[model samples]
Structure formats: structure tokens, C-alpha cells
Target: MQVDPGDPVEVNIWEAYIRTAVTHAEQDVSLVELERAAFYERCRNAYAVVATGESALYANLIIRKGVVAAG
Candidate 1:
């Protein structure tokens, strides 16, 4: 599936958050060989990855309040 880049990329940020719990509160994933759409969907469904990188494989968890507008 071709990720239209319109749906929003999500990610699993628990690990990142764990690492940055007191340091930052965000995580990162290195996806350089995965499909664009697949990466996006994975991130979107992830209850963690709060933020997404320019590509799709890279992502971070956002802390704050509301949902990250994928912007």
C-alpha cells in the first residue's frame, strides 16, 4: 500500500519514552528499508510514537495533551 502521506505516521514510543523518561520523554525508530505506507500505518497505530520524522521510519513520542495533528 502506498502511504499517501496524508494519513499520519505513528510509532511505538514506549521504548523511547523509557529511555528519555526523565531525560526527554521521546523515542526514535530507524526504518530505512520499510515501505513508506507500512511505516506510516505502523506509527499511526502505535500508542507511543507521538511525532513522526520527515521520512516515516523515524518517529518520536509527543507529550502534552491532545493528539498530534500529524503536522
Candidate 2:
């Protein structure tokens, strides 16, 4: 399930993917861990907010808009 850098993905489809991943995960894992794994798989770096730290469990999921060229 490798996605191209600029591939257009529908919101619903992405949601489903995440849900399925969590549901079928080998062991119980937090949403944060699941998302971070996804970022790593895509070869992308993720920075945690200092304020949130590890306390922010089940936090808001970050969505990448990708690179958009200025017209």
C-alpha cells in the first residue's frame, strides 16, 4: 500500500484504511502509534508538539495536504 507523494486520496478512503489497520493490528496499540508508523512507512518525518508530549493520547490526526504549486 505504497502511496505516491502527490497521489490524491479521498478522505473517506483514508479513514477506512486507518480504521482497518487499527482493527487488524497484531496487538493493541494507540492511535498515535498507528499514525506514527504510517508516517514512518511513507518515509516522512513527524515532529511532536512540546505541549502535547506523550500526554496527548488519541489526539487529532494530522493530515498532509502535500505540495501544491502556486498557479
Cα RMSD (angstroms) for every candidate in the order listed: 12.1, 14.8
Model 1 gets an lDDT of 0.46
For model 2, which pairs clash? none
lDDT of 1 by residue, 1-71 (tens): 23345667555444454566556434443224345665566667656653345443434233334445676
Candidate number with greatest lDDT? 2
Q: Where does model 1 exceed 4 Å of error? A: 1-32, 52-71
lDDT measured at residue 69 in model 2 versus the true structure, 0 to 100 = 64
Q: Residue 64, candidate 1: how far off, in angstroms?
A: 21
Local error of candidate 1 at residue 15 (angstroms): 19
lDDT of 2 at 51: 38
The lDDT for every candidate, in the order shown, is 0.46, 0.47
